[model samples]
Target chain A: MTTIGENATIYREQHRVTYYECDQTGRATLATLINIAVLASEDQSDALGLTTAHVQSYGVGWVVTQYAIDVTRMPRQDETVTIAVRGSAYNPYFAFREFWIQDEQGEQLAYITSIWVLMSQEKRKIVKIIPALVTPYHSEAVKRIPRLPRPIHFEADTQTISKPYRVRFFDIDPNRHVNNAHYFDWLLDTLPAAFLLQHDLQHVDVRYENEVQYGHTVTAQVNQLPVAEDGTVTTSHVIQVGEEKCCEVTIRWQPTTQPQA
Target chain B: MTTIGENATIYREQHRVTYYECDQTGRATLATLINIAVLASEDQSDALGLTTAHVQSYGVGWVVTQYAIDVTRMPRQDETVTIAVRGSAYNPYFAFREFWIQDEQGEQLAYITSIWVLMSQEKRKIVKIIPALVTPYHSEAVKRIPRLPRPIHFEADTQTISKPYRVRFFDIDPNRHVNNAHYFDWLLDTLPAAFLLQHDLQHVDVRYENEVQYGHTVTAQVNQLPVAEDGTVTTSHVIQVGEEKCCEVTIRWQPTTQPQA
Candidate 1:
C-alpha cells in the first residue's frame, strides 16, 4: 500500500472561474460548485496514487451517497479561487470527505462534507471499506459512522411545482450513470426563475437514493417551506423516475442584497 | 482604439481535460469542446484589451451565428491540450474566427471555424461591425463576406426521432439567454445510445437561428441520412420551440474501431 504522511492529507488547487461555469448572474451555479469540489477529491486521490482504476481493480468503485454544503457566497466568473479537499475519516463501509473553496485572499466561499461508499461493480452492492484504499490519504479509521445532516423530509401532501426532464446522453459520466452534479441542476431548475435570481443559496443537503440512467425521464418536484423568522426561505426537492425516488434535496436561501438584472 | 500588430492575431492557451468535461467514453463532449474554443477566443479578447464588457460598453455584444467543426478525435480525460483561436477576417456585418485544439505532442485534434456578429443588446438586431472592435484583434478588413458551408437543410417530411427539453435556469448565461453550447447537448441527445457509443464524430455544422429563453420547452428533432459509400453516417437535427425553429445542425460520424464498453 502507498503511504503518506498525515500532514499531506489535504490537497488544494487553484482554478479560474470561467464564463461557462457560471449562470445568468455571472456566479458559479450550484452544480458547478459541487463539480469543482468533486474534482478536488479526485485530484487528491490521484496525488496519493489511489487512482479510480487502481481502486476499481479490486472490483469496487467509489460512489457518493450524500452531501451537506454551506455557502457564504457563490464565486463569480473571472474570479480565481482555490479548491481544497481532504479525506477525513472512514468506517467499515463509509468514507467521510471534506471540501472547501476559498478566494485568493483565503476567505472561505463554500464548505462541503460528503459521504462516499464503495460499491461492487459486478453485484452493484455496497462493499466494505478496505484499509489499503483509505490508508494512503492518512484518513482516520473510526468504528462509528459520523452523522451528517439529512435532507429535510418532503411532505407527500404538500403543494409542489414539478418539471420533467429527459436525461441527456452527455449527462452520463465514465461510469455510465447520470452524474451527481446534474442532479443539482434538475433540483434547482424546478424553482421559479424569480426566486432563483433573487435569493442566494445558504445551505444545501442532498441525498442520492437511486442511480438515474440515460434516456430515463425524471421529474423534479419542489415545495417551499414557510419562511423563517430571519426571512430565510427553504425549499425541498425530490427527483423521481416515475414511482421510484432517485434523490432528495433541501436548500436554504437568503434574499440577495442586489438581485440579478 | 487599441491597435494590435497583425502578427499577434493568434492566441493560445493550454487546458487539462477534466473528468466532468468528458462523457461515458472518457472523451470530451462536443458541447465542452465548443465551450473551450469559445473561452479561448474570450481569453484572446481579454489579452487584446477588447473584453466583453468593453465591447458591451458600445451597447453591442458578439453573438456566434454558425460553427463548422472538423474533429480528428475527441480529447480524452486527463489529457492536457492546447486551444488556440485567431480572429481571421471581418466585413461590415460579420467576423470570422478560427479555433484549433492540439494534443500534447502538438498533433491537431480539432479545428473549428465560426461566424460572429455584433447584435444590439437593446434592439436585439444585427449591428454593423465596428472597425474599432475588430482593429484591436488585428483581423483583416475585407469587403467580401466568407461563404462557409451551411448545415444541410432538414427536410420537413423526413421521419424524425424527437425529444422535448425544458430550458433550465442554469442554461442561461450572463446575457439571460440559453448559451450556445447547450444546444449541442439537445441536438446530439436525440440519437440512440448504441449509435453514440459506436461512432466517432467527424464533423459538425450548426447554425443558430433564434435565441432560446428560460422556461421555454424545446423539442430536438433528428433524422438520419443515407450512409455514405465509405460507411460514414450523417444526421440532421433541428431544435424547435413549438413552431419556431431555434437552431439546426448536421453531423457526420464514422464508426469507431473499438466501441465503448
Candidate 2:
C-alpha cells in the first residue's frame, strides 16, 4: 500500500479487520470505523509524547466534543486498512483533528473531522489548551478551525419515533464515561430495520452535548425528513436523559437499488 | 516474554490492549478478555490452514458450545499481553480447545476451556469433523473431554430479577448469531450496580444452548444465592427468548474489602 504521508505532519496505523468487528454484511460498521480512527490517534499520541501515561500524570485528558463523518464505501472483514490522522488546528478552547481511512490499495474509503477539548480529570471541567501540548504535536495554528455543518432544523411540532436505551456497564470506557461511538448504535438502531436494510448510510454528523453515565436510561428520538425527488433521505436524532439532551445526530442515506443495471 | 510454544500444537498472538477495551478500573472486562481469546484462535486458524477463506469455501464454520474462564488478575489498558490457544481433542460431534493469557513478564493472568462444533452455513446443522481439518494443528486426542460444571439450578418458585434486553445490531457477529461474549454483558448488567461495584468477579462458567439473532428481545434472569460465611457469593443466570432458554451462566464473586489493612 502507498504511504499515507512521508513527512511528520500525518500519523498512520494499519489494522486488519477482525470477524468480531464486522456486521452481517461482512463489512465494518460505523462504530468500528470510528474505533479505527481512535486507535490511530492513540498511536499518534504515544509517538508525540502525549501518551496516556504522560497526560494522566498532569491530571488532564482530551475529550471529544463533536464529529462529522463521510463515507464512500465500507471495507469487508479481514481487509487490511489504514487510518491516517492529522492535528488540524487549535485555539484556546478547542482543537481540531482530521481522520481518513484507506483500503489496502491506498484508495480513500471514509473521512472524519472531530472537535475536542482538554479537561481537568478531578473537576471534569474544560481547561485551556496548553502551549506545550500543541507544540509537541507540531500542528499548525490556524486563525479559524472549520466546524461541522449546522444541522437542518425540523418542524418544532413534528412527532418523532422514540425508543428507550439503557446504558450498560460494558459501554463504559476507561475514561469512566460512555464511549462516543456507542451513541451511533443508539441513534442508528432507532430506525426501522426495513429502512436500514433498504438504504445505505452515506453521511453522518453528530454533536455530543452531555456525557452519559453507566446505569442511566435515555430515550432515543428520531425524525425522518421529507424524501427528495432523487430518492435521497435524511434523518434527525436526539438522545435525551430525562429532559436533558445528551447528543444529537443527523444522517443521510441513499437507496440500495443498483443504478442502471 | 517467554515463548508460548515452538510447535504447531499451540497458537499464540500478542496484543497491546487499547483504551476502549478497558473499563473504568483500567482493566480489561470479562467480554474483552473473551474477545482476545477469540481473536487469537482466529489467528491460529489462519496460521494452521483453516483460515476464514478456507472455512467459508466449505460452507461450514466453528461455533462455541461452552466456556469456563478462571481469572487471577486483569491486565490494565496499554499492557501488552499474549494469548495462546491449543486444540485439545475432538470427536465426531465436539472439539475441545484451551486458551491462556499472560502478561509481558510471562505471568499467567487467565485461562479458558471452550467446546466447539462445526455447523453448516446453509443447513445450520452440526457437521462431521473431517480429520484433515484437525490434523494440520497436530493436537492430541483424548479418551474423553471434560465439560464445564453444570450451573447450580435455582428453585423454580424462587423470585428472580429479570431485565429486558434487546439485541442491538452490532451485537450480531459475522456469523449472524449473537457473539458469545456479549452474553456476559446481558447477564452481568442485570445485577444491581451497587453489588457489582462492591465485589470482584472471581470465576465464570457458561454454556451456550441456543442462538440469539439480531433484534431478538430476551429476558435476562438473575438469581443471587445467599452469601457464604467467608464472603463468597454465587449467582445463577439464564437468558431466555420467550420460553426458550438461550444460554446459562454461573458466576462467583468475592467482596472487594480486605479482612484487614
Candidate 3:
C-alpha cells in the first residue's frame, strides 16, 4: 500500500513523459491530456483502498460519464509532467473525482473534473454510490468541490452527417464509445498543431450527443462557448463539420478546474 | 429522445458484431466486453438526445470505477448478440447504468454493472450530481451497487524486466492505459492459438501493477485463474523464466465473456 502524500504535496501522484504523448511542439494533445486523467484516476483509486473486487462486490462498476477541463499548458515529447489527483465528494451512488497536471517546473498546466456512476452488473442498470465505501475519502478531501453546469447538446437541430468517417479499429475501448481520448484527435485534427499549442483550453464540456459508428461519420463542428458576464475571455468551437454532427469545440478562455500556481 | 423501455423487451436483436473484439477462441473478451457496453450506451445516450458536448457542460465526466462479471458465456466471432441498456439512477453526483447481453437466439451470456462519479472542471474536484442533469433518464435504480472480490495479485514483486516489448505505436490510446484489449496478445504469445481457446475467463482484474517500459520484456504467468476453480490450469511468469516477479498474473476459466447463443 503506497501513500500519495509521500510523492505528491497533497495526495498520491504519478509522473509520466512518454514520447507518443506529444506532437512536434512536444506538447501533449487534449486527447493525451484525457489519457493523463485516466492514468491519474486509476492511481488514486488504487490508493484509496478501493480494489476492483471491493468495487464489484457491490454488483456495480465505475464508468466515466463526462468531463470538463481547462488546459493552461500541454506537455511536449519526453517532457515529464506530474499528475496530482484526488477524490472530491459524492451523494450515495457516484464517485466524483479531480485531477491536476503540472510540469517539471511545478508550473500548473491542466485541470480536470469528471462524473461517474455505479450500475448493476447483472441487470445492467445504474445504482447509487454506497456511503460505507466512500465515507473514508470524503473525510480526507483536500478542499471544496465546485458544481459544474450541464452542457446543452444540440442534437435536435444538429446537422446530419452524410459522409461517415472511416473510424479506426484501435479507437474502440473496453466500453467502446470511441475511447474518450480519441475525441482529442478528431478535435485537434480540425486545426493546425501550432494553433492548438499556442492556445490552451480555458474550459470545455462536451456532452456525448451520439455515437460515431464504424464506417459511419458524425458531423464535427466548433463554436465559441457562451460568453460569461464579466466580459471575461469567451469560448469558441469549430461549430459544425463532418457529416454526422460530430463537432470540433473550443472555448475562449476560462481558468476553471486547474488554476495557475 | 430515445429511452430503454422496461416492460417492453426485444427477445432477440441482431447485432453486426465486429472482429477486433476477440480472444483466441475468436470471440470478444471481458475487457472488450466493456467496449460492447459503451456501444450500446452511446446508442442509448443518443436515443436520449444527450450529445458528448452536452455531457461535458456539466463539468462532470463519467468514467468506469468498478466492474464484476462471470465469463460463463461470451459471443464468438461474428456471433450477433442482443444488447439491452438503460439508466439506473444518479444521486447528486454519480449515475448508475446497467447492461444485459444475450445471444441473437436470446440466451444469457454475462451480466455487468458499474459506478461513475461527477466532478468540477475548473477546480478538478468531485461535485454534486444535479437532478436536472440526470432527470432525463427515467428508470428504476438502486441505492447500493454490488461489488466483486478481486483475486490476490502475485506478491513476489520484482521489476528487472528487460525482454523488450516493442511499443506498438498502434497499441497506444489517447489516455494511454495500454489499451486493455491488447493484454490477450501478451498472454497468448507463449501458447498456440489452439491452446488458448480451450477455456474462458471466469473473472479477471489486473492492477497493471506496474508500467512495462517502452522497450522492456513483459513476462507473464498463467497459473492461478483456472485452478481449483478447476485446478488443472497452471502457468508462471517472471521477468526471466527463472527470475522473481517483474510482473505476475493469474487467469481462470468458467465459460467465456462471449456466450454462445
lDDT of each: 0.87, 0.80, 0.52
- Quick one: best lDDT, which candidate? 1
Ordered from best to worst DockQ, the candidate numbers read 1, 2, 3
Query: In candidate 1, what are the lDDT values of residues A144-240, reduced to their tens digit?
Result: 6566789987765547998888788999987667888998988888888899889999999989999988878999999999999999999999999
Off by over 4 Å in 1: A1-8, B1-8
Q: Which candidate has the top score in TM-score? A: 1
Ranking by lDDT: 1, 2, 3
Candidate No. with top DockQ: 1
Give the CAPRI class of candidate 3: incorrect
Q: How does chain A of every candidate compare to the true chain A by TM-score?
A: 0.95, 0.91, 0.69
Q: Model 2, A238-261: lDDT tens per residue?
A: 888998888888889888653211
- State the local distance difference test value for candidate 1: 0.87
DockQ of each: 0.77, 0.60, 0.02
lDDT string, candidate 2, B1-261, tens digits: 212223338888888787777766677878889988998988888887788768878888888988888887777788999999987777777778889999999999998888888889999899987667766777544445666677765443356888889988778777666787888889988888777767777788888888987888998989998898988899999998998888888998988642211
